[model samples]
Target: VPKGVILTHHNFISNVRTCVAMFDITSRDTVLSFLPLSHVLERMVMFAYLYAGTTIAFAESIEAVAQNLIEIKPNIMVSVPRVFEKIYARVMDNILNSSSLKRRIFFWAYRVGKKYAARQLQGEKIPASLKLKRQIAHKLVFSKIIERTGGRVRFFISGGAPLAKDIAEFFYAIGLIIYEGYGLTETAPVLAVNRPGALKFGSVGRPIPEVEIKFAPDGEILARGPNVMKGYYKKEAETREAFEGGWFHTGDIGYLDEDGFLVITDRKKDIIVTSGGKNVAPQAIENLLKTSSYISTVVVLGDRRKFLSALVVPNFEKLETLAREKGWHYTERKELINKPETVDLIKSEIDRACTGLASYERVKRIALLDHDFEIEKGEITPTLKVRRTAIENRYRELIDSLYREESSVSSDDFPSEESK
Candidate 1:
């Protein structure tokens, strides 16, 4: 069996191949490796380094990545979206916690820079004044944050979750090349990635140098290339179902842009078909909801129903701050969410956020969950992805109660409405 000596085995082969193809690491290159050896991403990079005769410096733990990064200052980095998100969040949080004048200046610069970057991504010709302002922002604000990311990070690749476009553009504006990629465990992983020089803000770049991609009539993405897996380990039927006419059938629904970049819409199975037969992609709606700092998670539900509804989990910290500012009495999470006033506040926020969405995709009703959904509770995956089926199963009763016309009770007060 093809094997690697470092990191976890999650998507090992693809990760290894990615390193070989992209970085072109040689005997002289040094890589600071810390991701779990059991994960395919890390394992592949480790093996690739070995094959290239490059020096490998393994960090003691994730806690030590920063210290190790400063010491090693490697030429390339591969990490999950969470790591980057935390870095962006920390920088933004620090600015927010700074003096009011400094915070205002930072935000003003950030907003202007972000708008400029968005225009650039759209291929609009930037005005000279806006371009000069962006340069000033890069020097005064964004560059400092990039320096904190070890300063030597030539390229940062994000996968395992959607890297918010704003975050991607923020890094780009700061002169850091943060490329987004798309893959799966079964594909031996690396199918498409945003190339270093040629990148897009919203799109996840084009298919990698060797991969081939096509779309099914139903819009599901189908892949074919050397990187694709042979088949499922022991599930022959599943393997057969996964490959259609020589193309590995990816359950994800997406389209290839005019320039051949892949833009994933949502999962085919995750599509919510309303009673009027309108197909709504919930991930789009969920992504829109998350843009609101107050919302942590949102699950849209409306399959075979008249309209879309959602269960939202608030960012408790932000919610609490809002509560304090508004002079609300509730302190506990449950008490806060169950309050009529809080419910109305969240409803207003939801309506505001979903205002631009299609009528069918708009969240018509919402129920707030008392606690954040966690993996330990089997509501989420180890990767922190929501297990949609598990969530629907766990909250069947609560969801039913929300839809009941006669029900006036809170989410916690509702009876379990599980169907037989």
Candidate 2:
């Protein structure tokens, strides 16, 4: 295995400089730093803040980030999609669980706010009636969401993991911007970032200054830049493989869209080549499923199998609330998760998420689990990334059972769509 990458002083400084320039971070800006300093992404951003003479407030812990955001009133921050996802889920849960009048008002205001923001982005002229409606919407609903962050956040620089488009849109709808980007530890962690004024929902923006990126024959991203690391420590063979033909092999499959923004499909090694020869990217499907408030964690499986299936971990709190409303009875956690109604609830969510996806990309079967993939269980990495091999090994029986049951059929087998 590759032990570690050798990043030099120049690489760090180059990344920090490029990052600060991207955001135009200034001394007036206050950044909330919650991610561990040991991680290259955080470390680079921290140094960039320092380089720009920006104020950095350390968060107490990962769990305390929400509270810290209000107290710090940060002008800019770095975060992964999980943070945004949790916030989105909480907001949706609150609105959905509220009174009928309040729910209607909240949703109505949300639409107006989104329309206003979209129009603003397009530089379209706003009519007086629409302007007044937007102002009312902002005061009635969007203001409360903004107040959660202490109302001063300019933007959130997101990376580490792919940010779901729906989650990004939710933030934008509330007048908050989440700028999603892409990179790995080996690339000093910031190869490309969505700049302040030019943000796209899904695509990671153009490469930073001095970085040259290209796609390989198989669509793997290859790069040659000052930000790239020298080599892996004491692993000559691995280093050679990493830097073959004078380019650093990123091991990520992606392409430059029409506008030259980088769009990551999935990890090269994680691509699932189904028995039918269709190459599917699990991350996209997994990200889509995780958009549902009920879903907490999802692992898509089917490398050499017939079709894709998933192991889903539901947000137990939301599920319990639903169970109460539906009058479902269960004594223990396992009993609750194994109940027929509970399974059907998860099935409905999976089906909704799979609606617009390609037939092969849709999850044919899913096993609902009460527990999340935990790092201590060796099912996930310390960074909270699911270890695919470890998960497959640990849940071998459950996964086999999903495929074994003839009852697990494609989304097409379900009844025609009805209004939600």
Candidate 3:
């Protein structure tokens, strides 16, 4: 628990150099900085920006980033997935509430843009007719999306969490690519990152030039390189345990795919093993659920239980709008979500979202909370990652009630294998 991660000068310099070469950062580029510099990932990227003599402008606050984007017109930036998630939800919510004709046109352009992007990613030949259609699609839809981001974004570098594949592809269809990366505090915070042109949608990309990686017997990721931390600052015993056979134990569980790209399953300690002995990764389910505009956040909760369930936080702003339109009356958020109609609506949405998942992985029941998991309340980390143990402890009673229903959720609530 006390293994200190001390990054050496060489480690910091090497990571910065790798990023500079990978992105071809130059004096001409301007970066809008928002992530805290206390985070090693932002620290290294900031160093690289200074090394290349690129201009750095700090965002006044997280809420002000949108206005800053327009005012400064940054050429490149680094961010976590939450920013993208918010933008995606807002854009989708507007479309969902728009006129039928506009909705149809937007979706048509979306499909055409996705096809064009797919061809470009694969280096496949594009027929002239398809190219002509793509041009029309951009003129009508994609260009407007880019304008919302100040129309000068080159690309974004995302990390600190897993980015959903569909969200990454959505950006690509609109001509903005989010190149994702992966690492931990012990590895000077960057071990692998996707390159600009050679992008893989869900992967965190290959190892950096100076690092060597391998998987353990239990599938824990292991690394050895100049970039790896020296050792625990004062705890020799913990340091020894972290480094066995000269390889730093990452404590993260993942494996490289056939293409040598890292596919993180989940944290080694976070995988939930059901009572039936089936192993399930909660992050996969949570990512899919978060795509719903009504669901702002979710935590999968079926560890050692007969079936899966969820602790959900709804988008209150959207819910209020719906309540207004429906002429529903409520004085409290909790009372609002407890209505029979609201529960039915959320259940249907969950069923539709989980249609593609296996039976054992789909959420069987859910408890919708009026408020989100807040960092100040100790439910999440400063970086916004959920503190699972704390959240579980805080919501113990709510979670227990989900398992107390007399009957298991009906099959009709979750799609069958054939229906998928």
What tens-digit string does per-residue lDDT give for candidate 3 at 188-298?
A: 889888987668888888888888999999999999887888887987888899899889998888888888888788888889899989899898888898898888888
lDDT of 1 by residue, 246-277 (tens): 89898999999988889888888888898899
Error of 1 at 60 (Å): 7.2
Ranking by TM-score: 3, 2, 1
Summarize candidate 2's per-residue lDDT along 12-114 as a digit string, tens digits: 9999888787778999999899887888888889889999999889999988999999999999988877888889989998988899999999988888877
In model 2, the runs with Cα more than 4 Å from the true position are 125-129, 405-420
* C-alpha RMSD (angstroms) for model 2: 3.9
Per-candidate RMSD vs. true structure? 5.2, 3.9, 4.0
What TM value does model 3 have? 0.94
Q: How much lDDT does candidate 2 score?
A: 0.84
Q: After aligning candidate 3 to the native by TM-score, how far in Å is the CA of 183 from where it should be? A: 0.4
